[model samples]
Target: MEHPSNGLSIIGCLRPAFYDEESYLRGLFHNEDGDGYASDWKDGERLNFNSQSAGANICSTLYKLEIMRMELFSVYGVQSSISLQHFQDAEPDVLVHSSSEIIERFNEKGMKSNAALKSLCRKKGLNVEGANIIGVDSLGMDVRVFSGAESQTLRFSFKSRVTSGRAAEKKIQQMLFPRIQRKKFKAHDEGLKNLDSF
Candidate 1:
């Protein structure tokens, strides 16, 4: 059955405070919305993927999350973790040999919440979609999206990991209205600017 909120029903409402896994994933990798997963990975060697396929990194990440359970999920990647079997008996949902199912599910849910990220991009007139999210760190994330026929992934570094949805929305606003860049000077030169130089 589908989740009432249209997310991974398997891990339904186990933690209502951290509800909406899709949005959580999106926020986790909010950085990867516009590009492929691998290139943006800072520690590429750690991923240990044998194939360099289009969505391999994302697939690998999701696979690890499913297999390792929520305990070690945060250690691998993402700001938070959600155990699929938190409320039930432990059993493998998707095996390594056939990981496509888990990857597809991840893609579906991740994309569903991608709309919020896309809206952010649209307000900036970026015209991009949060195609797939690759990784999530404590501070920010990486997002994968299609740029024409090619896939390009970019990093979205946040000031901090969002603790709540409202906080996430506020952070997005902060991203939207970035601090104006200003010329820098030596410490001693800081107070030498003329009042009318503005």
Candidate 2:
């Protein structure tokens, strides 16, 4: 997935919920800061390095943090502080569908959210060749993008949780349109450089 200027890894709508700071801290047990993994269950957050750590370790720790967050919510019942906005459902032609519902409706099928997400991405002038919508939650979506031998999971958060598909698409457009323009401008500049070489 393209990295937008807004810092989102991928674009998708999030569900509404209030987040508890204490619960979030409780879940953050990695490195010396989090719970140690020296137990029978071997369940804990272990951070062997910090921001100055190696790139690979940093990536691993980031994923570990995500796990910690889910554990916090599941075991501690910590809800996000963010709330969802109520909106009337729109026609399917206007928007894809309620992302949460679409995810559920197509759960049995592999890569269920692919089509909807692809449409959204394309609308924002993004490349969706190797992009996959791995998971969609109330908070947002987990989008996995593959580039050659490397892949990355990007977390995209929504400003508000929208009920209808149109609202979701509109929200994404608002968040991404500006960033998409920047990306296009950069690409065009690079193309111009190549033209000079030719």
Candidate 3:
């Protein structure tokens, strides 16, 4: 899949004809028995060496799968191929450019801000100490939780849909700081009532 803002392409085969195909490819590029492996990508102007680090690899794989799942399946179970223009025409829940900032904000607040996320983590026996947001959309976000040497991705859904980055930010803020937002809303309502009384 290609990012609209950047010309960079993420190439991966989601399904292999044979089950062993994935293991074979992984062996070639990520062999624990070997001296490790390296992958490179070049776009004429720049050559980038892809790291085989555990965190990097997991993030890349999760991102690819998430994008594919969102693009291929409209409502999770249903699958359909969609055109790039059509996908673009439908406003994405979270804008690509704003994703980084949103993720950063969520990280800064830590897991304490989101009770649902914290509860889910506890139910799954995941350690929220080093957890972080890897991917997010209007529906929810993919959080990476670490436990010892292992890591897993957890999907945390939002209460409602967000069409733009601003909306997503507001939704996240409301989720993260419910009491503050409620007070702000209450104050605004009171101010409006006062104006009406005048």
Predicted structure with the largest TM-score when compared to the true one: 3
Task: Estimate candidate 2's alpha-carbon lDDT, on a 0 to 1 scale.
Answer: 0.45
Cα lDDT tens digits, model 1, 1-198, are: 011111222232222112224345445444455544332233432222123446553333322233334333322233445555663575442232333332343456554346645655566457773455454333554456554665555567777665543444455445533443112223325656554377
Pick the winner on TM-score between candidates 2 and 3: 3
Off by over 4 Å in 3: 1-94, 110-120, 123-128, 174-198
Models ranked on lDDT: 3, 2, 1
lDDT of 3 at 114: 51
Q: Which pairs of residues have clashing backbones in candidate 3?
A: none
Task: Please provide TM-scores, in order, for all candidate models, with all chains considered together.
Answer: 0.27, 0.28, 0.40
Worst lDDT window (10 residues) for model 2?
67-76
lDDT of each: 0.43, 0.45, 0.55
Q: In candidate 2, what are the lDDT values of residues 80-112, reduced to their tens digit? A: 422213112322432233565644544444453
Of the candidates shown, which would achieve the greatest lDDT relative to the real structure? 3
Worst 10 residues of 3 by lDDT: 1-10
